[model samples]
Target: MFCERSSGDVQKEDKSSSVAVILCFFGEQQQGGVSDEAEPFMGSGRFGKSPTSPLHHVKVVSSPFHVALKVNFLCQLFIRLWPDGRNLQLHFRSRLSLPLFTGGKVEGEQGAAIHIVLLDVNTGHVVTSGPESTIKLDVVVLEGDFNNEDDEGWTEEEFESHVVKEREGKRPLLTGDLQVTLKEGVGTLGELTFTDNSSWIRSRKFRLGLKVASGFCEGIRVGEAKTEAFTIKDHRGELYKKHYPPALNDDVWRLEKIGKDGSFHKRLNKSGIFTVEDFVRLVVRDSQKLRTILSSGMSNKMWDALIEHAKTCAMSGKLYVYYADDTRNVGVVFNSIYELSGLITGEQYLLSDSLSDSQKVQKWLIYTKNWFDFDH
Candidate 1:
């Protein structure tokens, strides 16, 4: 369980598209009732999701302090009594954020982890203790491409049901161990950690969801709770230092520094594509035309590998950074390659009108061009 210092409120950078999507997920439904002579579900605390819930019934939130870079990992669990008064509502309030370190190493290399926080929603307090159970909590990570928006994108029904949808089209980026142990027995508070070492997490968005199997509730409730879609952010300095690991920082880091044993390295050097930065420009600029890239006597398999290698280099290579006085520098460059990568697609989603479509396109071209200059 986090302390009161961590529990206090912290202001966060504003995100346009997702801010509203979160509100639609928790659901605005009235606090339904629970029957069978309600008693504390935990050792002795009151549960949230109850209007008549004792002072203990309130949503559990994260410590207010967070960085402006990555998405914040926060969740709210609601326990409500159903009209039958026999079952409780296992509702989840999930948050989503993408924490990419500027000029740092891979985001998922160490693996993505989430702490499942259980709370007495009726009470403002966090559940410090774990209840005994044979069956454990299950954690699932789901993702979508919010950057790919449409005219009617943020509808309430579709956004709210994203987690619970049992349809086959669902794209789950990664699934932790079967039967996640939500109650890690950390202490008075019940907290559990689930982690995934998936390679694709770098480019996609993430959300955390939970399920409590049957009989664990001792015939009380069999349901789940989920956090709204959110990713966590590490400060620039904190994140910048994570990139020096040897495994991820290999030959792809620089064309000039590649091992001399390979013919590919020799060819690149002959062409004067020495540093990783130079090679990235060649791949990206040449890739604008498939024929141009393939014209270098490259086989189909070799061409694909080349682009993939370039992508790895772009993702893993560390840039030489120095403190500057007045020259403008862009820290993070956000782009949606979802279409090329076949990530989540939304045909009916709404697009933000803060800028005209043409104006947005113009700004994108200028930004990409500027990025190329800075890297070169």
Candidate 2:
């Protein structure tokens, strides 16, 4: 058997071989917001490698800290476990690319907004009910490298308990304080704006540090959470030129095409469907996945309507009254909208200045009357 010492050193646990042993899974308070590699966990005490030994849950110390594995798998009788920190996990994530549009955004020029949220950390399960939770948000913006060893940079936490420690000597990235109420009892809204006196920062890398207050879960006082640092840059027209906007609005949940039932959307998130583009891809690529998008169930009529809705959104912003033509589905698109506008309205009526307005109307009426009589 083997165990992890509090000093973070791992060695053989020869003394505790006869008895089951538990190791404290303590994660270091990371400063840079980068993805830190957690130490390896070896099973012991009726766990780890011996199915005949015994079976029980392995409780970890940190409660709610996140650990990302490069290539991991769980097998039949082998298991490692931890308390879910009373289900409090901040949703702050490591963002690689941030783009901007008119609706609002996280990265780009000034006047963009930063949205905050707290999720009952999903460990491959759908948490349908949200607690009467309230999260206090405070963001600190830094001009340079936030991960410097000497500085106590941003720490990502969802609970209120650890937020005080993170903000002890830190400065915020935004100009002023911020807060808001979440309808689902887990999210809020805030804009990213600096005070007028703050100098222009058109060409600098800024790290978004966040802290959230802890809330109650099943009568136990759960601790707060610090999220991973999200790096936002002021790209100054560089990001806009290369990037393309998504088919749907940035806030995919608020879309009308998807029903407003909150539980339905929650299931979508659990299935790795966040954006409409992600949802559309699933519906178009696989029929079974589309029918099963709702955990409860959806009728074929509703499913077909949504699939058509998604395809309409994908091809063009406007919805068209036509079925998908699989035979001629592939195509080369042109700027035919403007080119056909003259034909649609009649090119002669548009340019003939000698014809009076009434005469033009009469000509169109006479031609339409004759055309409709024969066509009908």
Whose TM-score is greatest here? Answer: 2
Clashes of each: 46, 18
| Tens-digit lDDT string for candidate 1 (251-354) | 43232223444555666656665555455555544555533523555667756655555455324323322111134331222322111111111222123245
Model 2 ranges off by over 4 Å = 1-87, 92-114, 123-132, 142-173, 181-183, 195-203, 214-340, 344-376
User: What C-alpha lDDT values do all the predictions have?
Assistant: 0.36, 0.38
Looking at model 2, residue 177 earns an lDDT score of 44
Indicate the worst ten consecutive residues by lDDT in candidate 2: 334-343
Candidate 2, 375: how far from true, in Å?
Answer: 36
Model 1 C-alpha RMSD vs. true structure (Å) is 23.4
Mind giving the per-residue lDDT tens digits that candidate 2 earns over 1-376?
Answer: 1221321111223323312333222234344121222222234423344533221233332323222220121110012122333344444423323432222244422333434445554353223354434535445444333344443333332222222212334344344345544445455345444322112333233344554333423332222323333333344433333213336433345333454446666788878778666666455435587567663665667566556655445333332111112343221111111111111122222333454566556444443444323211
